[model samples]
Target: MVLVDAAFIIELLLKYSFPVLRDENDRIFNKPLMLQDVWSHLQLLENQLSFFILEDLFVPEKIPVSSYGEDAEKLSIISLSLELFTSLMHIEGIEENLKTITSTFC
Candidate 1:
């Protein structure tokens, strides 16, 4: 169940970045507030997954290369996450913030 939950969150992050990859019928994407709602639920401490588990699931090798010879793998999971949440959270200095945040976890 933990793996499934983690996969769901990873899928949310991926689809958040690439809207084209999202299922048109997905209820979460169909309702704007629903995504935020889910995000809120995920923020609860008990609902959280370990960062290592998320990283293992979203490893670079698991991502497929795109036509431009680039993949979402180029960005760390932290960056991909910030790409979605930073806007919702109204964060500033994303690049610098990412660096500082990533360093702490390292």
Candidate 2:
């Protein structure tokens, strides 16, 4: 269950980072509200997979840096997680708050 959860989150992030990778038939991205629903579910504390598990499973070193272009820093699980979560927020300085939360955990 843990691995499945982690994989799902990681896959969603990848699809988000590179829209070219998103399948035309994928219901998650195709349905107007599905992606938002998924994001909301991710906000639930009990639904989270530990960052360590995600990082370890992500294998960042194996992925080519060139694929991320100049913003290679965004390739990390932390950045991807932030990009996803921050999209749901309308608050000012939410990125800073999210960074603080992540730093506390790391």
| Model 1 Cα lDDT, one tens digit per residue, 3-105 | 9998998888877776767777988989869988998898999999998898887765555433325554434678778888887788877678768877898
TM-scores for all candidates: the values are: 0.80, 0.76
**After superposition, which runs of candidate 1 have C-alpha atoms over 4 Å from their true positions?**
65-74, 99-106
On residues 18-99, what C-alpha lDDT tens digit does candidate 2 reach at each position? 6776778987989999988997898899997777899889976665553666756677788787776667664356677767
lDDT of each: 0.77, 0.78
Give me candidate 2's TM-score against the actual structure.
0.76
Candidate 1 global Cα RMSD: 2.7
* Top candidate, metric TM-score: 1
Residue 72 Cα positional deviation in candidate 1, in Å, after optimal superposition: 3.8
